[model samples]
Target: MTPIRHNASGGSDNDTVLDAVRDCVLAVGVRRTTLTDVARRAAVSRMTLYRRWPDVRSLVGDLMTREWIAVATGAIPAREPGTTARDMLTEGLITAVRAFRAHPLFRKILDVDPELLLPYVLDRRGASQEALLELLSGSLREGHADGSVREGHPERQARSVLLIVQSFTLSLRTMTDEDDPDLASEAFLRELRGILERTLTP
Candidate 1:
Protein backbone atom coordinates (compact mmCIF):
# COMPACT_ATOMS: atom_id res chain seq x y z
CA MET A 1 0.00 0.00 0.00
CA THR A 2 1.08 3.61 -0.66
CA PRO A 3 1.68 6.10 2.09
CA ILE A 4 -1.29 8.31 2.90
CA ARG A 5 -1.76 11.72 4.48
CA HIS A 6 -4.86 12.56 6.46
CA ASN A 7 -6.09 15.79 7.93
CA ALA A 8 -9.13 17.72 9.13
CA SER A 9 -10.23 17.91 5.49
CA GLY A 10 -11.32 14.29 6.02
CA GLY A 11 -10.94 13.77 2.32
CA SER A 12 -9.08 10.85 0.89
CA ASP A 13 -5.32 10.86 0.68
CA ASN A 14 -6.05 11.12 -3.04
CA ASP A 15 -7.44 14.56 -2.41
CA THR A 16 -4.28 15.51 -0.59
CA VAL A 17 -2.25 14.28 -3.49
CA LEU A 18 -4.47 16.26 -5.84
CA ASP A 19 -3.98 19.42 -3.82
CA ALA A 20 -0.28 18.83 -3.91
CA VAL A 21 -0.60 18.40 -7.65
CA ARG A 22 -2.05 21.91 -7.94
CA ASP A 23 0.75 23.48 -5.91
CA CYS A 24 3.37 21.74 -7.99
CA VAL A 25 1.58 22.65 -11.21
CA LEU A 26 1.37 26.28 -10.22
CA ALA A 27 4.91 26.50 -8.87
CA VAL A 28 6.82 24.36 -11.31
CA GLY A 29 4.53 23.65 -14.28
CA VAL A 30 3.19 20.21 -15.20
CA ARG A 31 6.23 19.00 -17.07
CA ARG A 32 8.51 19.27 -14.10
CA THR A 33 6.04 18.32 -11.37
CA THR A 34 6.90 14.79 -10.47
CA LEU A 35 5.14 12.56 -8.00
CA THR A 36 8.13 12.97 -5.74
CA ASP A 37 7.87 16.72 -6.02
CA VAL A 38 4.19 16.67 -5.14
CA ALA A 39 4.90 14.38 -2.21
CA ARG A 40 7.61 16.73 -1.00
CA ARG A 41 5.36 19.72 -1.27
CA ALA A 42 2.48 17.98 0.50
CA ALA A 43 4.79 16.42 3.13
CA VAL A 44 3.55 13.07 1.96
CA SER A 45 5.54 10.19 0.59
CA ARG A 46 6.17 9.19 -3.03
CA MET A 47 4.55 5.85 -2.46
CA THR A 48 1.46 7.63 -1.18
CA LEU A 49 1.16 9.74 -4.30
CA TYR A 50 1.86 6.83 -6.57
CA ARG A 51 -0.84 4.81 -4.89
CA ARG A 52 -3.30 7.58 -5.77
CA TRP A 53 -2.07 9.00 -9.07
CA PRO A 54 -0.08 6.75 -11.29
CA ASP A 55 1.52 9.54 -13.30
CA VAL A 56 1.77 13.26 -13.89
CA ARG A 57 -0.84 13.35 -16.68
CA SER A 58 -3.57 11.77 -14.58
CA LEU A 59 -2.71 14.04 -11.68
CA VAL A 60 -2.70 17.08 -13.94
CA GLY A 61 -6.10 16.17 -15.40
CA ASP A 62 -7.59 15.85 -11.94
CA LEU A 63 -6.20 19.19 -10.80
CA MET A 64 -7.31 20.90 -13.97
CA THR A 65 -10.91 19.80 -13.39
CA ARG A 66 -11.03 20.95 -9.77
CA GLU A 67 -9.52 24.30 -10.68
CA TRP A 68 -12.21 25.01 -13.26
CA ILE A 69 -15.04 24.04 -10.94
CA ALA A 70 -13.64 26.08 -8.07
CA VAL A 71 -13.18 29.18 -10.17
CA ALA A 72 -16.60 28.99 -11.86
CA THR A 73 -18.58 28.42 -8.69
CA GLY A 74 -16.41 30.53 -6.40
CA ALA A 75 -15.68 33.56 -8.55
CA ILE A 76 -19.06 34.12 -10.17
CA PRO A 77 -22.47 34.52 -8.63
CA ALA A 78 -25.66 33.01 -10.01
CA ARG A 79 -28.05 35.04 -12.13
CA GLU A 80 -29.96 37.70 -10.27
CA PRO A 81 -33.46 39.05 -10.92
CA GLY A 82 -33.76 41.91 -13.46
CA THR A 83 -30.34 41.02 -14.80
CA THR A 84 -30.33 40.20 -18.48
CA ALA A 85 -29.36 36.60 -19.08
CA ARG A 86 -27.01 37.76 -21.79
CA ASP A 87 -25.16 40.07 -19.43
CA MET A 88 -24.53 37.47 -16.74
CA LEU A 89 -23.56 34.97 -19.39
CA THR A 90 -21.20 37.44 -21.01
CA GLU A 91 -19.58 38.19 -17.70
CA GLY A 92 -19.26 34.54 -16.80
CA LEU A 93 -17.80 33.64 -20.17
CA ILE A 94 -15.36 36.50 -20.06
CA THR A 95 -14.44 35.74 -16.49
CA ALA A 96 -13.80 32.10 -17.24
CA VAL A 97 -11.79 32.96 -20.32
CA ARG A 98 -9.70 35.62 -18.62
CA ALA A 99 -9.04 33.38 -15.67
CA PHE A 100 -7.90 30.54 -17.87
CA ARG A 101 -5.84 32.76 -20.12
CA ALA A 102 -4.18 34.69 -17.31
CA HIS A 103 -3.48 31.71 -15.16
CA PRO A 104 0.24 31.06 -15.11
CA LEU A 105 -0.34 27.41 -14.44
CA PHE A 106 -2.81 27.01 -17.31
CA ARG A 107 -0.63 29.08 -19.57
CA LYS A 108 2.27 26.88 -18.72
CA ILE A 109 0.23 23.83 -19.58
CA LEU A 110 -0.81 25.36 -22.89
CA ASP A 111 2.73 26.30 -23.68
CA VAL A 112 4.02 22.85 -22.90
CA ASP A 113 1.26 20.39 -23.72
CA PRO A 114 -1.84 21.93 -25.22
CA GLU A 115 -3.45 18.57 -25.86
CA LEU A 116 -3.98 18.28 -22.12
CA LEU A 117 -6.70 20.88 -22.45
CA LEU A 118 -8.42 19.23 -25.40
CA PRO A 119 -9.68 16.09 -23.76
CA TYR A 120 -12.58 18.20 -22.61
CA VAL A 121 -13.20 20.16 -25.79
CA LEU A 122 -16.89 20.10 -26.51
CA ASP A 123 -16.84 16.62 -25.12
CA ARG A 124 -19.33 14.82 -22.92
CA ARG A 125 -17.05 13.79 -20.04
CA GLY A 126 -14.29 16.14 -18.96
CA ALA A 127 -13.47 19.22 -16.96
CA SER A 128 -14.93 21.67 -19.46
CA GLN A 129 -18.24 19.85 -19.59
CA GLU A 130 -18.54 19.20 -15.87
CA ALA A 131 -17.46 22.63 -14.61
CA LEU A 132 -19.42 24.57 -17.20
CA LEU A 133 -22.53 22.41 -16.88
CA GLU A 134 -22.58 23.01 -13.14
CA LEU A 135 -21.89 26.72 -13.37
CA LEU A 136 -24.39 27.38 -16.17
CA SER A 137 -27.22 25.27 -14.77
CA GLY A 138 -28.23 27.72 -12.09
CA SER A 139 -28.04 30.74 -14.33
CA LEU A 140 -29.97 29.07 -17.08
CA ARG A 141 -32.66 27.93 -14.71
CA GLU A 142 -32.93 31.43 -13.32
CA GLY A 143 -33.01 33.00 -16.72
CA HIS A 144 -35.62 30.65 -18.01
CA ALA A 145 -37.87 31.11 -14.98
CA ASP A 146 -37.47 34.87 -15.18
CA GLY A 147 -38.11 34.92 -18.92
CA SER A 148 -34.65 36.10 -19.83
CA VAL A 149 -33.61 33.22 -22.00
CA ARG A 150 -36.07 31.69 -24.45
CA GLU A 151 -38.54 29.38 -22.72
CA GLY A 152 -38.22 26.35 -24.89
CA HIS A 153 -35.51 24.34 -23.12
CA PRO A 154 -33.28 25.91 -20.49
CA GLU A 155 -30.83 23.16 -19.74
CA ARG A 156 -30.18 22.13 -23.31
CA GLN A 157 -29.56 25.68 -24.47
CA ALA A 158 -27.33 26.42 -21.51
CA ARG A 159 -25.12 23.49 -22.35
CA SER A 160 -24.85 24.58 -25.97
CA VAL A 161 -23.90 28.14 -25.11
CA LEU A 162 -21.39 27.02 -22.49
CA LEU A 163 -19.74 24.68 -24.95
CA ILE A 164 -19.38 27.58 -27.36
CA VAL A 165 -17.94 29.82 -24.67
CA GLN A 166 -15.39 27.22 -23.69
CA SER A 167 -14.49 26.62 -27.29
CA PHE A 168 -13.86 30.31 -27.89
CA THR A 169 -11.99 30.60 -24.61
CA LEU A 170 -9.74 27.69 -25.48
CA SER A 171 -9.07 29.07 -28.95
CA LEU A 172 -7.65 32.27 -27.50
CA ARG A 173 -4.53 30.40 -26.54
CA THR A 174 -3.82 29.55 -30.17
CA MET A 175 -4.10 32.95 -31.83
CA THR A 176 -1.26 33.99 -34.09
CA ASP A 177 1.44 36.07 -32.44
CA GLU A 178 0.59 38.85 -34.86
CA ASP A 179 -3.11 38.66 -34.02
CA ASP A 180 -4.49 40.52 -31.05
CA PRO A 181 -5.89 37.88 -28.72
CA ASP A 182 -8.05 40.31 -26.77
CA LEU A 183 -9.59 41.76 -29.91
CA ALA A 184 -10.27 38.33 -31.29
CA SER A 185 -11.80 37.27 -28.03
CA GLU A 186 -13.95 40.33 -27.83
CA ALA A 187 -15.15 39.84 -31.37
CA PHE A 188 -16.02 36.24 -30.71
CA LEU A 189 -18.01 37.20 -27.65
CA ARG A 190 -19.77 39.93 -29.59
CA GLU A 191 -20.92 37.45 -32.20
CA LEU A 192 -21.90 35.06 -29.47
CA ARG A 193 -23.97 37.74 -27.75
CA GLY A 194 -25.84 38.33 -30.95
CA ILE A 195 -26.76 34.68 -31.06
CA LEU A 196 -27.86 34.81 -27.46
CA GLU A 197 -29.93 37.93 -28.02
CA ARG A 198 -31.80 36.21 -30.81
CA THR A 199 -32.64 33.37 -28.46
CA LEU A 200 -33.75 35.58 -25.56
CA THR A 201 -36.89 37.72 -25.42
CA PRO A 202 -38.94 39.73 -22.93
Candidate 2:
Protein backbone atom coordinates (compact mmCIF):
# COMPACT_ATOMS: atom_id res chain seq x y z
CA MET A 1 0.00 0.00 0.00
CA THR A 2 1.29 3.45 -0.89
CA PRO A 3 1.72 5.56 2.18
CA ILE A 4 -0.57 8.56 2.25
CA ARG A 5 1.00 11.98 2.48
CA HIS A 6 -0.45 14.45 4.90
CA ASN A 7 -1.47 17.56 3.03
CA ALA A 8 -3.51 20.50 4.30
CA SER A 9 -5.41 20.96 1.04
CA GLY A 10 -6.86 17.44 1.10
CA GLY A 11 -6.52 17.14 -2.69
CA SER A 12 -4.45 14.11 -3.65
CA ASP A 13 -4.19 13.58 0.09
CA ASN A 14 -7.82 12.51 -0.07
CA ASP A 15 -6.88 9.73 -2.49
CA THR A 16 -4.28 8.56 -0.02
CA VAL A 17 -6.87 8.19 2.71
CA LEU A 18 -9.22 6.47 0.30
CA ASP A 19 -6.48 4.02 -0.61
CA ALA A 20 -6.02 3.27 3.05
CA VAL A 21 -9.77 2.79 3.41
CA ARG A 22 -9.73 0.35 0.50
CA ASP A 23 -6.93 -1.64 2.09
CA CYS A 24 -8.65 -1.74 5.45
CA VAL A 25 -11.99 -2.77 4.06
CA LEU A 26 -10.44 -5.48 1.92
CA ALA A 27 -8.49 -6.94 4.80
CA VAL A 28 -11.14 -6.66 7.55
CA GLY A 29 -14.45 -6.06 5.80
CA VAL A 30 -16.46 -2.84 6.16
CA ARG A 31 -17.98 -3.66 9.55
CA ARG A 32 -14.57 -4.32 11.08
CA THR A 33 -12.82 -1.46 9.31
CA THR A 34 -12.71 1.71 11.35
CA LEU A 35 -11.46 5.24 10.88
CA THR A 36 -8.64 4.49 13.27
CA ASP A 37 -7.52 1.60 11.09
CA VAL A 38 -7.67 3.80 8.01
CA ALA A 39 -5.61 6.43 9.78
CA ARG A 40 -3.01 3.87 10.71
CA ARG A 41 -2.87 2.43 7.20
CA ALA A 42 -2.70 5.90 5.68
CA ALA A 43 0.12 6.74 8.12
CA VAL A 44 -1.85 9.82 9.07
CA SER A 45 -3.09 10.79 12.49
CA ARG A 46 -6.67 10.10 13.52
CA MET A 47 -6.99 13.85 13.87
CA THR A 48 -6.19 14.22 10.19
CA LEU A 49 -8.81 11.69 9.18
CA TYR A 50 -11.38 13.24 11.47
CA ARG A 51 -10.54 16.70 10.21
CA ARG A 52 -11.99 15.69 6.86
CA TRP A 53 -14.58 12.99 7.35
CA PRO A 54 -16.81 12.89 10.42
CA ASP A 55 -17.61 9.19 10.26
CA VAL A 56 -16.60 5.95 8.58
CA ARG A 57 -19.70 5.92 6.38
CA SER A 58 -18.98 9.40 5.10
CA LEU A 59 -15.39 8.46 4.35
CA VAL A 60 -16.38 5.27 2.61
CA GLY A 61 -19.06 7.04 0.64
CA ASP A 62 -16.49 9.51 -0.63
CA LEU A 63 -14.17 6.64 -1.44
CA MET A 64 -16.85 4.89 -3.48
CA THR A 65 -17.68 8.06 -5.35
CA ARG A 66 -14.05 8.67 -6.16
CA GLU A 67 -13.44 5.13 -7.30
CA TRP A 68 -16.52 5.02 -9.53
CA ILE A 69 -15.70 8.38 -11.07
CA ALA A 70 -12.15 7.30 -11.73
CA VAL A 71 -13.34 4.19 -13.48
CA ALA A 72 -15.94 6.01 -15.57
CA THR A 73 -13.72 8.88 -16.63
CA GLY A 74 -10.72 6.66 -17.29
CA ALA A 75 -12.78 4.36 -19.46
CA ILE A 76 -13.69 7.15 -21.89
CA PRO A 77 -11.74 6.57 -25.07
CA ALA A 78 -10.12 9.25 -27.16
CA ARG A 79 -12.04 10.18 -30.26
CA GLU A 80 -10.57 7.75 -32.74
CA PRO A 81 -10.34 8.58 -36.44
CA GLY A 82 -13.51 7.62 -38.32
CA THR A 83 -15.34 6.63 -35.15
CA THR A 84 -18.62 8.42 -34.56
CA ALA A 85 -19.45 9.88 -31.17
CA ARG A 86 -22.27 7.38 -30.80
CA ASP A 87 -19.74 4.60 -31.25
CA MET A 88 -17.43 6.25 -28.75
CA LEU A 89 -20.21 6.58 -26.20
CA THR A 90 -21.18 2.95 -26.55
CA GLU A 91 -17.60 1.81 -26.33
CA GLY A 92 -16.93 4.04 -23.36
CA LEU A 93 -19.94 2.76 -21.45
CA ILE A 94 -19.01 -0.84 -22.22
CA THR A 95 -15.45 -0.19 -21.18
CA ALA A 96 -16.64 1.40 -17.94
CA VAL A 97 -18.81 -1.60 -17.16
CA ARG A 98 -15.88 -3.89 -17.74
CA ALA A 99 -13.63 -1.74 -15.58
CA PHE A 100 -16.20 -1.69 -12.76
CA ARG A 101 -16.62 -5.46 -12.96
CA ALA A 102 -12.89 -6.09 -13.01
CA HIS A 103 -12.00 -3.64 -10.24
CA PRO A 104 -10.65 -5.65 -7.32
CA LEU A 105 -11.63 -3.19 -4.63
CA PHE A 106 -15.10 -2.77 -6.13
CA ARG A 107 -15.64 -6.52 -6.34
CA LYS A 108 -14.44 -7.02 -2.78
CA ILE A 109 -16.79 -4.31 -1.58
CA LEU A 110 -19.67 -6.00 -3.39
CA ASP A 111 -18.81 -9.35 -1.83
CA VAL A 112 -18.04 -8.30 1.71
CA ASP A 113 -19.56 -4.85 2.11
CA PRO A 114 -22.49 -4.75 -0.24
CA GLU A 115 -24.31 -2.30 1.99
CA LEU A 116 -21.77 0.31 0.94
CA LEU A 117 -23.35 0.20 -2.51
CA LEU A 118 -26.92 0.72 -1.35
CA PRO A 119 -26.89 4.43 -0.58
CA TYR A 120 -25.41 5.30 -3.99
CA VAL A 121 -28.02 3.28 -5.82
CA LEU A 122 -31.00 4.04 -3.63
CA ASP A 123 -30.57 7.79 -3.20
CA ARG A 124 -31.44 9.88 -6.26
CA ARG A 125 -29.15 12.72 -5.37
CA GLY A 126 -26.25 10.55 -4.26
CA ALA A 127 -22.67 11.45 -5.09
CA SER A 128 -22.30 8.39 -7.30
CA GLN A 129 -25.14 9.48 -9.57
CA GLU A 130 -23.84 13.00 -9.75
CA ALA A 131 -20.37 11.92 -10.69
CA LEU A 132 -21.64 9.55 -13.35
CA LEU A 133 -24.03 12.17 -14.63
CA GLU A 134 -21.23 14.66 -15.08
CA LEU A 135 -19.07 12.17 -16.94
CA LEU A 136 -21.90 10.94 -19.18
CA SER A 137 -23.17 14.43 -19.91
CA GLY A 138 -19.78 15.50 -21.15
CA SER A 139 -19.56 12.51 -23.45
CA LEU A 140 -23.10 13.10 -24.75
CA ARG A 141 -22.23 16.68 -25.58
CA GLU A 142 -19.31 15.46 -27.64
CA GLY A 143 -21.62 13.03 -29.41
CA HIS A 144 -24.05 15.81 -30.21
CA ALA A 145 -21.32 17.93 -31.79
CA ASP A 146 -20.25 14.99 -33.93
CA GLY A 147 -23.78 14.59 -35.29
CA SER A 148 -23.75 10.84 -34.69
CA VAL A 149 -25.92 11.16 -31.62
CA ARG A 150 -29.52 12.36 -31.68
CA GLU A 151 -29.97 16.09 -31.11
CA GLY A 152 -31.40 16.53 -27.63
CA HIS A 153 -30.46 17.65 -24.19
CA PRO A 154 -27.16 15.99 -23.37
CA GLU A 155 -28.07 15.75 -19.69
CA ARG A 156 -31.31 13.95 -20.51
CA GLN A 157 -29.60 11.57 -22.88
CA ALA A 158 -26.85 10.94 -20.38
CA ARG A 159 -29.37 10.16 -17.64
CA SER A 160 -31.10 7.62 -19.85
CA VAL A 161 -27.82 5.92 -20.74
CA LEU A 162 -26.57 5.99 -17.15
CA LEU A 163 -29.73 4.32 -15.87
CA ILE A 164 -29.50 1.58 -18.47
CA VAL A 165 -25.81 0.96 -17.91
CA GLN A 166 -26.14 1.05 -14.12
CA SER A 167 -28.92 -1.50 -14.17
CA PHE A 168 -26.94 -3.90 -16.33
CA THR A 169 -23.60 -3.42 -14.61
CA LEU A 170 -24.98 -3.70 -11.06
CA SER A 171 -27.07 -6.72 -12.02
CA LEU A 172 -23.97 -8.81 -12.75
CA ARG A 173 -23.75 -10.33 -9.28
CA THR A 174 -27.43 -11.23 -9.28
CA MET A 175 -27.30 -13.66 -12.17
CA THR A 176 -28.99 -16.95 -11.34
CA ASP A 177 -29.04 -20.49 -12.75
CA GLU A 178 -26.72 -19.74 -15.60
CA ASP A 179 -25.44 -22.78 -17.42
CA ASP A 180 -22.68 -20.79 -19.12
CA PRO A 181 -21.98 -17.42 -17.68
CA ASP A 182 -19.72 -16.33 -20.52
CA LEU A 183 -22.27 -17.13 -23.19
CA ALA A 184 -25.02 -15.51 -21.19
CA SER A 185 -22.96 -12.37 -20.71
CA GLU A 186 -22.12 -12.20 -24.40
CA ALA A 187 -25.76 -12.55 -25.35
CA PHE A 188 -26.78 -9.89 -22.94
CA LEU A 189 -24.13 -7.52 -24.21
CA ARG A 190 -25.20 -8.13 -27.77
CA GLU A 191 -28.78 -7.17 -27.01
CA LEU A 192 -27.71 -4.22 -24.89
CA ARG A 193 -25.43 -2.91 -27.61
CA GLY A 194 -28.17 -3.21 -30.20
CA ILE A 195 -30.64 -1.32 -28.06
CA LEU A 196 -28.18 1.42 -27.16
CA GLU A 197 -27.05 1.85 -30.74
CA ARG A 198 -30.59 2.27 -31.94
CA THR A 199 -31.56 4.62 -29.16
CA LEU A 200 -28.46 6.80 -29.26
CA THR A 201 -27.75 7.01 -32.96
CA PRO A 202 -29.35 9.72 -35.10
Candidate 3:
Protein backbone atom coordinates (compact mmCIF):
# COMPACT_ATOMS: atom_id res chain seq x y z
CA MET A 1 0.00 0.00 0.00
CA THR A 2 1.60 3.23 -1.04
CA PRO A 3 0.65 6.61 0.31
CA ILE A 4 -1.90 8.10 -2.02
CA ARG A 5 -0.78 11.54 -3.09
CA HIS A 6 -2.86 14.36 -1.68
CA ASN A 7 -2.81 18.06 -1.06
CA ALA A 8 -2.80 19.84 2.30
CA SER A 9 -6.35 18.65 2.61
CA GLY A 10 -7.26 15.38 0.98
CA GLY A 11 -9.50 15.79 -2.04
CA SER A 12 -11.10 13.53 -4.62
CA ASP A 13 -9.21 13.84 -7.91
CA ASN A 14 -6.20 11.66 -7.13
CA ASP A 15 -8.24 8.97 -5.53
CA THR A 16 -10.45 9.21 -8.54
CA VAL A 17 -7.49 8.52 -10.79
CA LEU A 18 -6.33 5.64 -8.63
CA ASP A 19 -9.74 4.10 -8.55
CA ALA A 20 -9.99 4.27 -12.31
CA VAL A 21 -6.55 2.77 -12.76
CA ARG A 22 -7.32 0.04 -10.28
CA ASP A 23 -10.52 -0.91 -12.01
CA CYS A 24 -8.70 -0.90 -15.31
CA VAL A 25 -5.90 -3.03 -13.87
CA LEU A 26 -8.38 -5.47 -12.47
CA ALA A 27 -10.08 -5.62 -15.83
CA VAL A 28 -6.90 -6.04 -17.87
CA GLY A 29 -3.96 -6.53 -15.53
CA VAL A 30 -0.86 -4.32 -15.91
CA ARG A 31 1.34 -5.97 -18.49
CA ARG A 32 -1.32 -6.09 -21.15
CA THR A 33 -2.87 -2.76 -20.20
CA THR A 34 -2.88 0.56 -22.00
CA LEU A 35 -3.17 4.24 -21.14
CA THR A 36 -6.27 4.59 -23.28
CA ASP A 37 -7.95 2.00 -21.09
CA VAL A 38 -7.14 3.96 -17.93
CA ALA A 39 -8.17 7.17 -19.64
CA ARG A 40 -11.38 5.62 -20.82
CA ARG A 41 -12.11 4.23 -17.39
CA ALA A 42 -11.19 7.49 -15.68
CA ALA A 43 -13.62 9.30 -17.96
CA VAL A 44 -10.90 11.79 -18.64
CA SER A 45 -9.50 12.94 -21.92
CA ARG A 46 -6.39 11.32 -23.38
CA MET A 47 -4.73 14.72 -23.18
CA THR A 48 -5.61 14.81 -19.50
CA LEU A 49 -4.06 11.42 -18.95
CA TYR A 50 -0.95 12.53 -20.77
CA ARG A 51 -0.80 15.69 -18.71
CA ARG A 52 -1.09 13.67 -15.48
CA TRP A 53 1.12 10.79 -16.59
CA PRO A 54 3.83 10.54 -19.18
CA ASP A 55 3.07 7.05 -20.42
CA VAL A 56 1.50 3.73 -19.58
CA ARG A 57 4.59 2.32 -17.82
CA SER A 58 5.05 5.52 -15.87
CA LEU A 59 1.43 5.70 -14.81
CA VAL A 60 1.46 2.13 -13.58
CA GLY A 61 4.85 2.71 -12.02
CA ASP A 62 3.63 5.72 -10.08
CA LEU A 63 0.72 3.75 -8.71
CA MET A 64 2.97 0.88 -7.64
CA THR A 65 5.49 3.22 -6.06
CA ARG A 66 3.07 5.29 -4.04
CA GLU A 67 1.00 2.30 -3.06
CA TRP A 68 4.12 0.68 -1.61
CA ILE A 69 5.08 3.70 0.48
CA ALA A 70 1.53 3.96 1.72
CA VAL A 71 1.59 0.31 2.68
CA ALA A 72 4.93 0.52 4.46
CA THR A 73 4.13 3.56 6.57
CA GLY A 74 0.42 4.14 6.64
CA ALA A 75 -1.19 1.28 8.56
CA ILE A 76 1.28 -0.09 11.09
CA PRO A 77 1.15 2.56 13.75
CA ALA A 78 4.48 3.07 15.51
CA ARG A 79 4.38 3.27 19.25
CA GLU A 80 6.25 3.05 22.51
CA PRO A 81 8.54 0.11 23.00
CA GLY A 82 6.85 -3.25 22.92
CA THR A 83 7.77 -6.22 25.09
CA THR A 84 9.56 -8.04 22.32
CA ALA A 85 11.00 -7.24 18.93
CA ARG A 86 9.26 -10.31 17.53
CA ASP A 87 5.91 -9.21 18.83
CA MET A 88 6.32 -5.73 17.45
CA LEU A 89 7.35 -7.06 14.07
CA THR A 90 4.48 -9.53 13.95
CA GLU A 91 1.84 -7.02 14.92
CA GLY A 92 3.17 -4.39 12.58
CA LEU A 93 3.37 -6.68 9.59
CA ILE A 94 -0.02 -8.21 10.25
CA THR A 95 -1.58 -4.80 10.55
CA ALA A 96 -0.07 -3.83 7.23
CA VAL A 97 -1.31 -7.04 5.57
CA ARG A 98 -4.82 -6.52 6.81
CA ALA A 99 -4.83 -2.98 5.56
CA PHE A 100 -3.55 -4.05 2.16
CA ARG A 101 -6.04 -6.89 1.96
CA ALA A 102 -8.84 -4.47 2.60
CA HIS A 103 -7.65 -1.67 0.35
CA PRO A 104 -9.72 -1.33 -2.84
CA LEU A 105 -6.65 -0.84 -4.99
CA PHE A 106 -4.66 -3.59 -3.34
CA ARG A 107 -7.50 -6.09 -3.52
CA LYS A 108 -7.70 -5.46 -7.22
CA ILE A 109 -3.94 -5.26 -7.47
CA LEU A 110 -3.03 -8.54 -5.79
CA ASP A 111 -5.37 -10.37 -8.08
CA VAL A 112 -3.88 -9.53 -11.47
CA ASP A 113 -0.85 -7.30 -11.04
CA PRO A 114 1.97 -9.07 -9.20
CA GLU A 115 4.65 -8.94 -11.86
CA LEU A 116 4.19 -5.23 -12.54
CA LEU A 117 4.78 -4.51 -8.86
CA LEU A 118 7.54 -7.00 -8.08
CA PRO A 119 10.22 -5.23 -10.04
CA TYR A 120 9.45 -1.99 -8.26
CA VAL A 121 9.87 -3.73 -4.93
CA LEU A 122 13.18 -5.09 -6.13
CA ASP A 123 14.14 -1.70 -7.52
CA ARG A 124 13.40 -0.11 -4.16
CA ARG A 125 13.73 3.36 -5.68
CA GLY A 126 10.55 4.99 -4.39
CA ALA A 127 9.41 6.47 -1.09
CA SER A 128 8.12 3.08 0.00
CA GLN A 129 11.64 1.65 0.34
CA GLU A 130 12.85 4.70 2.16
CA ALA A 131 9.90 4.66 4.50
CA LEU A 132 10.18 0.91 5.03
CA LEU A 133 13.91 1.14 5.66
CA GLU A 134 13.43 3.98 8.09
CA LEU A 135 10.65 2.21 9.95
CA LEU A 136 12.54 -1.06 10.18
CA SER A 137 15.83 0.56 11.07
CA GLY A 138 14.28 2.65 13.78
CA SER A 139 12.45 -0.35 15.19
CA LEU A 140 15.53 -2.53 15.02
CA ARG A 141 17.67 0.05 16.74
CA GLU A 142 15.08 0.34 19.45
CA GLY A 143 15.13 -3.41 19.83
CA HIS A 144 18.90 -3.43 20.12
CA ALA A 145 18.81 -0.71 22.74
CA ASP A 146 16.33 -2.77 24.70
CA GLY A 147 18.32 -6.01 24.36
CA SER A 148 15.67 -7.54 22.17
CA VAL A 149 17.67 -7.50 18.99
CA ARG A 150 21.25 -8.50 19.68
CA GLU A 151 23.99 -5.97 19.11
CA GLY A 152 24.86 -6.12 15.43
CA HIS A 153 24.55 -4.06 12.27
CA PRO A 154 21.10 -2.55 12.43
CA GLU A 155 20.98 -1.85 8.69
CA ARG A 156 21.84 -5.42 7.80
CA GLN A 157 19.33 -6.85 10.21
CA ALA A 158 16.61 -4.51 9.02
CA ARG A 159 17.37 -5.31 5.40
CA SER A 160 17.11 -9.00 6.08
CA VAL A 161 13.82 -8.62 7.87
CA LEU A 162 12.42 -6.53 5.03
CA LEU A 163 13.50 -9.13 2.50
CA ILE A 164 11.90 -11.85 4.56
CA VAL A 165 8.58 -10.08 4.59
CA GLN A 166 8.70 -9.24 0.90
CA SER A 167 9.66 -12.77 -0.12
CA PHE A 168 7.01 -14.35 2.05
CA THR A 169 4.18 -12.15 0.84
CA LEU A 170 5.13 -12.45 -2.81
CA SER A 171 5.45 -16.21 -2.51
CA LEU A 172 2.05 -16.49 -0.90
CA ARG A 173 0.39 -14.50 -3.72
CA THR A 174 1.02 -17.29 -6.21
CA MET A 175 -0.47 -20.04 -4.11
CA THR A 176 -3.67 -21.69 -5.37
CA ASP A 177 -4.73 -23.15 -2.04
CA GLU A 178 -8.38 -23.08 -1.04
CA ASP A 179 -7.35 -21.21 2.10
CA ASP A 180 -8.20 -17.57 2.41
CA PRO A 181 -5.70 -15.07 1.04
CA ASP A 182 -6.01 -12.94 4.13
CA LEU A 183 -5.14 -15.87 6.34
CA ALA A 184 -2.24 -16.81 4.12
CA SER A 185 -0.99 -13.23 4.29
CA GLU A 186 -1.27 -13.22 8.07
CA ALA A 187 0.62 -16.49 8.31
CA PHE A 188 3.37 -15.14 6.10
CA LEU A 189 3.76 -12.18 8.40
CA ARG A 190 3.86 -14.44 11.46
CA GLU A 191 6.59 -16.61 10.01
CA LEU A 192 8.57 -13.54 9.00
CA ARG A 193 8.41 -12.20 12.53
CA GLY A 194 9.59 -15.56 13.90
CA ILE A 195 12.53 -15.61 11.54
CA LEU A 196 13.47 -12.08 12.53
CA GLU A 197 13.17 -12.86 16.22
CA ARG A 198 15.48 -15.86 16.03
CA THR A 199 17.97 -13.98 13.95
CA LEU A 200 17.93 -10.98 16.24
CA THR A 201 18.38 -13.10 19.33
CA PRO A 202 20.98 -15.60 18.19
Decreasing TM-score order of the candidates: 2, 1, 3
lDDT (tens digit, per residue) of candidate 2 on 72-131 = 778878876899878877987888887887888788888888877776678655666776
Model 2: residue 98 alpha-carbon error in angstroms? 1.0
Clashes of each: 0, 0, 7
- Sort all candidates by lDDT, best to worst: 2, 1, 3
- The lDDT for every candidate, in the order shown, is 0.66, 0.78, 0.65
What's the lDDT for residue 167 in model 1? 68
- lDDT-wise, the better of 1 and 3 is 1
Model 1 lDDT per residue over 58-133, tens place: 7887777666665555546466776675567656666676677777667777777777776566334674365466
Q: Give all TM-scores, in the order shown.
A: 0.76, 0.88, 0.71
Q: Write down the RMSD of all candidates, one decimal each.
A: 6.3, 4.9, 4.5
Native-to-model Cα distance after best TM-score fit, residue 118 in candidate 1, in Å: 2.3
Write candidate 3's Cα lDDT for 1-202 as tens digits. Answer: 1233423112476556666776777677777678788878878888977876787767766666566667656656555564575457556765675666666666666676666666646764454555677677877777777777678787887777777766665556676364686676667666766776677674
Instruction: Identify the runs in model 2 with alpha carbons over 4 angstroms from their true place.
Output: 1-9
Clashing pairs in 3: 1-67, 1-71, 2-66, 2-67, 2-68, 2-70, 3-70
1 or 3, greater by TM-score? 1
